[model samples]
Target: MVKWDTLARPKEFGELGFLDTRAMNTVLLAKRTSHIDGCEDSPCIKILEKKKVLERNFFRTSHRGGSQFWQGLQEVKCWYERGRGCTVNCGERVKFRKDVWLGDCALKTSFPYLYQIYRERQCSVADAWERDWSLEFRRNLGQEEMVEWADLSGRLE
Candidate 1:
């Protein structure tokens, strides 16, 4: 069985991608106790119930629209910030630098075969960082100067 942590990582082994932690947490919560029937005795259900109670109280005291509920639903923010170890203030600004070549990054070096596959697909460095490289591009790059081009690119991830 695949470990949840492994699945939580960016799709590819070598890519510089990261899973959003908040999203992962929500998934964990939702999947905490899977059963044939939708029983409410699961840990996830209990936590969700507690969350609902807190939200109700919060809304009653303050005019907030249960921001935590919305935030919990939109797990992107927490995932990006905690998963990547990025500063919470401006995590969105931390994207894979396009000009960087995969060959030079330590993450790529650790997973050379995967990175090579990514380069063969002629994927942009940014795409590689996001683990979005396409198999079609990989096939095309086998006949092109993709490796060289990726190597020569000035930026590093």
Candidate 2:
């Protein structure tokens, strides 16, 4: 008997090509979420915005108090996030430390020590750049932290 997984493989892979509904639904939802912000003319988006359901960035929104559809969007957001990278232009939408704009990974991952002491962790890239990338920390830096700070600054330069 042919395995279900084998049957699901692509025709190019020498198996019967079967579309996986779960993966397709996940991809479709992810695509929808990714483009929803840009679709300003969409009536559904307009309604959600009017209701204040989309006050915050859709991906960052919590599922609490939202509908099952909102919860589903939240659930499928990870798929989009995993396959996405941000390009900082005005930087209004991209999170400074959390987004993968400057490199392959996030600044928080690149500079863990600085992130731990950073006061404005939620600030966007535009805000950070406006402050000349000189972010406020919770406390004074020691010698090691000073070196890291220098390295981070050098990257910006």
Candidate 3:
């Protein structure tokens, strides 16, 4: 079995790295059609859906003594909370720094490998020209030709 956790860390942390939900969702869709390996209707997908936490607009509280407390709300963008699909409130905001935020879903640190796999597969498909060319060249010429030109090429079967 593939170690998915190892695939979902930040690149600098030495893993494949985390990716946004849009890319992750694409991988889930393609997995249904057998395009990728290691994950298929996996538990991690459900875990991600169930535990998706969205950061919302921050409400800042300042004490009389100059101490500041930042409170983040659960964004109103979750489908379960809103009873709709892909609405603007689906938890896309995240506070990255003291007050700065990101307008995208950040996967929890635990599932970095799964996210990495998703990202890698999406990138590969998006850049399929080279992959397709290599596959075709191998099919037409020979395995020897493929070996000479490709770095790590091989058939699924």
Candidate 4:
């Protein structure tokens, strides 16, 4: 009997590549997500944006009492944020700590201590730039922190 785990493995390793239902759902709903603002002529999108969901950060915004379709899209948005890292083409939309912009890893994941002390954790890259990369802390970093900062600073572009 073929093991269930083996059957679900990626196609690269000779196992059947099972369809990723969550990923598929995310893609299907992404149509509505993308059209939220860009297509200004859309009445539905305009209406939705007027409400609590889309006025600001759509990814970080909560969608507690929306319709099933909207709730599904919100879930997809959460999944996308959790599973992927982004390359910075423009600093406008990407969150400074939450995105993988500086180098290989997300700043939050790569530097938890710094993130904990960060004054502008939710700021975007553009926002950070406006503030002059001034990530404040309560006290001076210790020797280990200095080493870590040096390493990460070198890696940061």
Clashes per candidate (backbone, < 3 Å): 6, 0, 7, 0
**Which stretches of model 3 miss by more than 4 angstroms?**
1-37, 53-126, 130-157
> How many backbone clashes can be found in candidate 4?
0
Q: Give RMSD to native, each candidate.
A: 18.0, 3.3, 20.3, 4.6
Off by over 4 Å in 2: 1-20, 142-147
Tens-digit lDDT track for model 1 on 1-157?
A: 7655666666577544567676667765333222201354666446656766433211123323555544443343333223232221322222232212223333334334434645343233344445533233254454334554465343332
**2 or 3, which is superior by lDDT?**
2
Comparing candidate 1 with candidate 2, which one achieves the higher TM-score? 2
Tell me the TM-score of model 3. 0.16
Estimate, for each residue in 69-152, the C-alpha lDDT of model 4 and write its tens digit. Answer: 879878777555654556555577789888767766688778777666667667888876666565566678877567666766
Better of 2 and 4 by TM-score: 2
Q: What is the TM-score of each candidate against the true structure?
A: 0.20, 0.73, 0.16, 0.65
Q: Which pairs clash in the backbone of model 4?
A: none
Query: TM-score of the candidate numbered 4?
Result: 0.65
Instruction: Name the runs in model 4 displaced over 4 angstroms.
Output: 1-23, 30-47, 50-52, 83-90
Candidate 2 local lDDT, 1-157, one digit each (tens): 9877888899999989998777888877787786774566787677778978898777677777788767777888766765567878799888898877877778887888878888987899999889888789999987777887898898898
Among all windows of 10 consecutive residues in model 4, the one with the lowest summed lDDT is 32-41
Over the stretch 49-85, how does candidate 3's per-residue lDDT look in tens digits?
Answer: 3543212121221212311110111121122112211
**Candidate No. with top lDDT:** 2
Q: Look at candidate 3 and give me any clashing residue pairs.
A: 7-113, 8-112, 8-113, 9-17, 77-89, 77-90, 77-91
- State each model's CA lDDT, in order: 0.39, 0.80, 0.30, 0.70
Query: Comparing 1 and 4 by lDDT, which wins?
Result: 4
